[model samples]
Target chain A: MLTYANPNRFMQLARRLTRPVWGLSLACLIIGLYMAFSAPADYQQGMTVRIMFIHVPAAWMSLFVYTFLTVSSIFGLVFRHPLGHVAAKSAALIGAGFTLITLITGALWGKPMWGTWWVWDARLTSVLVLFFIYLGYLFIWKAIEDPLQAGRVSSVLAIVGFVNVPIVKFSVDWWNTLHQPASVSRFDAPALHSDYLWPLLVMALGFQLLFFALWLLRMQTEIFKQKLRVRRLGLVETSNGTAS
Target chain B: MEHVFYIGLSYGVTGVILCLLTANTLSAFFSFRKQIDDEFKPEDSANSP
Candidate 1:
């Protein structure tokens, strides 16, 4: 872990991992989709059960990514890990994208089953709040000019905002929500049948891979931006010295 | 099937958004890489010492 604190080493690891991660993601997605379509529809939900392949994995990623962001923020804030802020900031947009997918697909799935486009159910509302927190985190990055200050502010916000994660996860169980409770993840045997469970896991893995691939690319970009900033500053200082 | 529209739209929207995000990230990456390389080219380094 400390090895990655060195930006050059981190860059090398990112370069090496990006292509393979992407390839594996594509492979998993292809297999996952095939299995999803082939799986039998729920007797109750019918054909609409197919939507779970994409939707459930996306919802998982939404929470997973934010948790990852929070961990990275902790590293940055507490340990002053150099790449920590870069990792957290790079992850924000990708996490937001997943959150958006979760909301949109959740609504799409909800409409046919619930007889409505949306509701203020505990599960639904908490997830929406999670999305807003993601947006707020990104806004902090954009609103502040100084990278160090932006990182500190956003990291603090991320750590504070993570309180919503547990609420979102437990909302279905804690309240009489229209949304269903955990199917794939639970203390007992998963609620999903093997048919749905297998492909859902595969798709979830694919989504996770996709997140890492994108996260690496975004982090490398941020590192390059930092390099450019430093080089420009050095050039300015050199010119000033010559002028003097 | 009536459910087809809902399912199709969901997948379609997901695909579009992921594609756009990928494109945006890739472009930003290349643009930043180019800028950094430009700032530290051979000529600039030769004059450093």
Candidate 2:
């Protein structure tokens, strides 16, 4: 990770990796959707449960991206790696996108499954709060002009925001909620059989790779902009020096 | 048919978003590389005393 901190080195690797990353992502998506659409209806939920094909993966990505952001922020604060902050910020934006997808798709699934468009249940509420945390982190970045100060402040928020993740995980167990308990999560036996499980896994992996590709893209953009800003500032300083 | 529609919709949205993102990334990559070259281009010649 630190090895790629230098902007040039990061760019080198990102450029080389983008094509293969995209290829694999698309391939998985094609095969995953094939399986998802071909799989039989649930004996219980019928057609509505198909939304899980998208909802589950989006939910996974939302939480996963936030976790990545928090870890990256911690590294930035401890090691003083500038790229760490860039990675964290880039990841925050992508995480928010995934969070939005999770909420929206969950709502779509819920309307038919739970007979409600929205719920204040534990699992849903925890996810809502998690979404807010993502926004709060992004807002902090924009609200402050000083990146270093923003990094410190948002790093704290990132660390604190992590508590919601476990709540999101355990909410079903802790409360009588309309949201279903963990089907794919429990270590005992997956409630889902092979007909459903494989497609879900494929979709999950596709979403994860998509997140990485986007994260790298965002980080590379931020690094390049920083370089551009530095060059412009240097020009201004040199002009001022010559004028004096 | 409804299930097929929903499945296609999901894949469609994902594809569109990824395509746009890829385009955005390529443009940025080319422009940045050009900037790096431009910043260093002037010193490459050998004619000046």
Candidate 3:
């Protein structure tokens, strides 16, 4: 793992993995969609329950990506690893996109089931706060001029903002929310039926694979951006030397 | 069913959003790669036959 701390080695690994990971993600999504559509509808929610196939997975990915971001930020701050900041920066947009999908799809599911588009419930509100934290992290990166300073500031935000993640997860249990408590992730056996459970798991796997594929691509782009910045600086220094 | 519209809209919106995100990430990746390649290519060409 430490061997990949070197950008050149990491780039080599990323180039090799990006295509295969993408292919696997597409394959999983196709299979997962087929399974999701074929699964029997719930007696309660009817066809509207199909929304869970997309909604739950996006929710899971949104949380998962933020956790990933926070961990990377920790590595960057504590270890001073070169690629740590790059990894955290690369993951922000992808995490935010997943969070957006979670919110929109949650609303679509809520309208039919809860008879409302949204509520100020604990789970929903905390997730919304999480999304804002993601946006703020991204904004800090853009607002700061120096890379090192931006990395340090945004990393602090990522670490602090991570407190919301567990709060979002346990919110339903902690409060009497309209949202149900954990169905598939409880310590006990899952509340979801095998029919819904299987397809949901497949979709979650697909979402995870897609996140990895995108993360590598974004990290590679960040590395190239860093390289270009250094090259431009060198060029300016060389011209100034000649002028002097 | 009556709720078919809700389900359809959810999946439809998700597909579109994911597609757009994927497109944006790919474009950014290729754009940066191209810039870096161009930045180095001149020095390579200048040194070669």
Candidate 4:
């Protein structure tokens, strides 16, 4: 783990892993989409059941990515790992994208099934708050000029905002809501039929792999940006020294 | 078949968003790499001379 803390070593690893990760993600998404479309429609929801293939996976990823950001923020704070900050920063946009997809798809699914486009239900409200928290975390990084300070403030906010995750997860059970409770995560067994379950799981995996591939690319970009800043600063110093 | 619109729209929107995000990240990466390479080439030439 410490060995990877070195940015150069990490970049080398990232470059080597990039092609394989991308290939795997592409393969998974193709298989997942094929399975998703092939699955028969639900007896109750009819064709709308198809929305679950995308909606459920997006919802899962929204939370998963936030949790990932929180963990990376913690590493940045505790270990002072630069890579951690880069990772957390890169993940925020992707996580926000997932959250947006979740909310929009949920609305689409809800309009057809629940006879409404939006609801102020506990589960829905909490997820919206989670989305705002992602925005706020990203805002802190943008507003602060100093990288260290920005990272520290953002890390603190991320840690604090993590309380909302569980609230979003358990809101359906803890309170009355239009949203359905956990179907696939329960210890007993997934409530879904195998036909639906398999595709959902595959899509979830594909989304996760896609997230990782994007995250790595973003992190690599950030590392290069940092290097560029340093080189430019060196050039400035060299000119200043020569002038003096 | 009526519900097909909602399902199609949902997947379409998600697909668009993911594609945009992927494009933005990759473009930023390539641009930064180019900037860093350009910065280094000048320095290397100056140092050799």
Model 4 docking category = high
Ranking of predictions according to TM-score: 3, 1, 4, 2
lDDT of each: 0.92, 0.81, 0.92, 0.91
Query: Where's the lowest-lDDT run of ten residues in candidate 4 chain A?
Result: A1-10
DockQ of 4: 0.88
Query: For residues B1-49, could you state the per-residue lDDT of candidate 4 as single tens digits?
Result: 7687898899999999999999999999999899888878887999999
Off by over 4 Å in 4: A1-5, B44-49
Interface RMSD, one decimal, each candidate: 0.6, 2.8, 0.8, 0.7
TM-score, second chain, candidate 3: 0.78
| Model 2: per-residue Cα lDDT over A1-244, one tens digit each | 4534577788889878877887887788788888887898888978766778888988888889888998998888888776778889888877877777788777766666677779998988899999999999999999999777888889989989999988988899999978888799779999889899999999999888877777777777777777777778889999999999
lDDT comparing candidate 2 with the true structure? 0.81
Identify the candidate with maximal DockQ: 3
For residues A66-160, could you state the per-residue lDDT of candidate 3 as single tens digits? Answer: 99999999999999888888899999999999899999999999998898999999999999999999999999999999998999999999999
Q: What's the TM-score of each model vs. the native?
A: 0.96, 0.87, 0.96, 0.95
| lDDT of each residue in A1-244, candidate 4, tens digit only | 4634599888999999888888888888899999989999889988888889888999999999999999999999998877888889999999999999999999999999999999999999999999999999989988998777898899999999999999999999999878989899999978999999998988898899899999889989988888777777888999999999
For residues A1-244, what per-residue lDDT tens digits would candidate 1 score against the true structure?
5533599888988899999999999999899989998999899999999889999999999999999999999999999999888999999999999999999998999999999989999988998999999999999999999999999999999999999999998898889978888877788998889999999999999999999989999999999988778878888999999999
Give the local distance difference test score of model 4: 0.91
Model 3, position A243: C-alpha lDDT score: 100
